[model samples]
Target: MSSATKYTRGHATFNVISKAILAGFATACLLPFILMIIGSFTDNTTVLVNGYSLFPEKWSLAAYELIFKYPKQVIDAYKVTIFVTTVGTAIALTITTISGYALSRPTFRSRNRIALYLYFPSLFGGGLIPWYIMMTQVLKLSDSIWALIIPSLVSTYNIFLVRNFIRTSVPLELFESAKIDGAGELRTFGQIILPLITPVTATVGLFIALGYWNDWFLSNLFITTSSKYSLQYYLYNMLNSSKALQELKAISGDISIEIDLPSETAKLAMAVVATGPIIMLYPFVQRYFVRGLVIGSVKG
Candidate 1:
């Protein structure tokens, strides 16, 4: 009968309803991935006949077996991708944050001009032929791992996101206070600014990591040696090879070619392998990602 009791009941009902809705949404999001995983394990013939399903009539490891047929190559690709993603993300995050902090500081008189310089390239680019020449002929980065790392190390969009987040979420007075305490720019940034911008940094780091992880074009363009291929590129090559084999079989009309390439299942398997590590990484940064997006999106 009391107002407090009614309020409590209403709040409890809202919580239950909200939780149920979120649960349903989460399940819906996960369903496709779950089916893909299951389909990867299902017999290729069964999958071809039945399409993808939660419950497959027949089970098989043909796809995984084919993928791991050259375990060394797969392992090497994994190593390359992991190293690139880790090192590239760290370096990119450092550069972006530092650039953003510099831009955000009102005392930096040339920030506007510098920002214009950074933003201009993003708007217009010299054609691919020139870019290729610059990388291969000018930089001499061909067949080198650095080729992959250097090209995408800094993103203009990410830099601006961090700059905006710092300007809006962080107070200018804090910088002045640090200066008064005899803190050098480096010391002040490390101790004060870095801590306040954790959410934005994590978000930017995640974006950089994903970009590095998913990048296949860089490897295709710059890398000639098979050993240096990143995971995405390696998988892309494998898929191409599989399709080639299928095409050859179709042309030959030879039922005895014995080319049992699990193309569809192999695709599913590749997705699982390539995405598994990055998917695991999401939960650790999920909270920061959401908070950063909110804080960064608010117009200063």
Candidate 2:
């Protein structure tokens, strides 16, 4: 690395090279998603010809039409997903924020021990069979929406993020002032602490929301009812069924049907539909997320 003064040749060269490199890297990252969007509109034959291009020679909505054919089912799945993400995120944030704050406080007697205990799960976990038994048999959460909400209500990693944010960014003097002024723990947390940690709270809240929104494994493991399927799980089932039927048809040598199913494009279209809103959510929280990451990265 060269240490150069302002506007020198080396500095100017590095700046130009850095800008081009970043631009290319960003484009590389976005290329697949761009291709996916284009591919969703490209029919099977056109895809065969163009093979995932910046611009497709032909375009069609047959895939989207196929997907929306069961609009009621899709809508119901959307409602279930929306409800889960909203309710689960709210509850998760409350639990994670409160626990993180408590753990972050120097005055808390067992803060270090509790933080370690909370972090243990992220390193190691009980086996899947035992976890399943606990949820289904012990807790009686099988086939219930609570199964989705409760199991992932708080994450060890997220708690640590919150803890670090509070310990580093929030001043202890403020808490002492609140204590001297006769503010209870709950009141201090709600009114003063909550307002101060808005950046970190938003960051953690976004993480929880994304986790809830994209969850499908919990549905696969616990949920059996079609009516209760989240959007991701519903799409997973659709894609799996389509692939299974295609495989069965190939094995059976059945070529009798005249109508072609939008197999590949439909899968891509479903991906687009499921994740579209989440992509839109990133911009709203990006500033807070950057601040939280920076603050949380600092050691206490």
Candidate 3:
């Protein structure tokens, strides 16, 4: 055989092996989600009781029916989640971008000290009890929607992401040109810096939105009212409500309510529901993350 033929054969074998490894990694990441999604549709219950089955022996829509029975509650949860995700992401991006821009500027004498100040939050947030009391008693924010929105307004990590992107991406000459154009600091930021950082902003915005959408802990703590609960927390309580004595007794007691809730399935389905929009969003937003990082490459 010719040397070229031998080399080609070896390269083809390497590509096949590389593809196989990647497929395995992808499966590892995706299989759980697939199982969870399928389980939601399955008639199966717990791991102890019903083994993991993708398809069901007896197909049932009872889980969905029960979920829909409280349509208003579900809708309200969706509203709260949507509201929090939108508002929180917007506020966070603005704050993070502005902070990042200031930090990225070389002339800012106190930049290092400022960075240290912001970074301190990452290492030394007070205990949860103190933070909760500060929000609830002193601020009188318990059971309020502000309880959910206000605390999540900024993240130290996101600020760093924006700073990194801005430091590397935004050109100093552009800032100088804007100053020469008679643009004030706000104008320079609004017209120049923001437009250029679209990639990172979109990427970070999605991150912020997902964080708010998925969060249930804050709602559990400061929020006591059912109406004010975000979608994730609302679903959390509903998910556990399967074992609630009243729900069980009612399902059994009422002939009119012949609903057989596949509570386990509903939990899975609700998770799928809660995450569906986010999953759809990821592909589009993920495109931004790479392109943004590339656009923001640090120049020497």
Candidate 4:
């Protein structure tokens, strides 16, 4: 009968309702991935006949078997992708954070001009032909792993994200305090600024890693040797080859040659394979990612 007891009950009910809604929303988001994973295991014919389902009538490993038919190639592609993602993310985070910090500092007189130079490319590009010529003819990066790492080393958008995050989330007094302690730019950055911007750093690092991981365009353009192909590019080639085989079979109607290439299921399988590592990586940065985005986009 007490007023405080009624308020407590109301708050508890609100919490329960909120949690239930969030749980349902989370399940809705997760169902598609579950279906895709299950659908990949479903028989190709069954999928065509019944469509995707969480519980498929017939489950098969044909798609996975085909993907891993040559395990060595997949493994090599994984190695290349891992190397590129690791090295590229490190270098990218370094450059982006440094550039962002410099631009965020009010003492830097040329920051506005430098930022204009950085932002100009985001709005306009010099066309792909020139970029390709520069990469292949001038830089001589063709068929080299550096080709993959160098081109995507610094993202303008990422630099801006870091700059904004630092400008908004970090205080100018911290920089001054570090300077007062006789710390140089590098020392202040490493000792003070870096730790304070952990959320944005994780967020930017995740973005860079995902970009490097999912990149297939650079591989398709610069890489001639199959050995240097990234995982996504390798899987893309495999999927294309599967489609080609399907098309060939369709074209060669009366030949009576049996070809059992999983097309739809192969695509599902490739998605699963390519996204596995990224999915695993997401949970680690999920805590920082949302916070970083909010603070970084606060219009500081």
* Model 3 lDDT tens row, 116-223: 998897898787888888999899998888888888777776677777877776777988898888998788878888888787788777767777999999899878
Cα error, candidate 3, residue 223 (Å): 1.3
Runs of candidate 2 exceeding 4 Å displacement: 1-5, 12-20, 48-53, 256-262
lDDT of 1: 0.87
Candidate 4 per-residue lDDT, tens place, 16-56, comes to 99999999999999998898899889898888898888889
Per-prediction TM-score: 0.83, 0.87, 0.80, 0.81
Arrange candidates, best TM-score first: 2, 1, 4, 3
The order by descending lDDT is 1, 4, 2, 3
Worst 10-residue lDDT window for candidate 1 reads: 254-263
Give the runs in model 4 whose Cα sits over 4 Å from its true position: 1-31, 44-54, 254-267
Give the per-residue lDDT digits (tens) of candidate 1, residues 52-79: 8899999999988978896787898999
Clashes (candidate 3): 1
Q: Model 3 scores what on Cα lDDT? A: 0.77
Query: In candidate 4, residue 30 scores what lDDT?
Result: 95
Q: What does the lDDT read for residue 295 in candidate 4?
A: 65
**Weakest 10 consecutive residues, lDDT, candidate 2?**
255-264
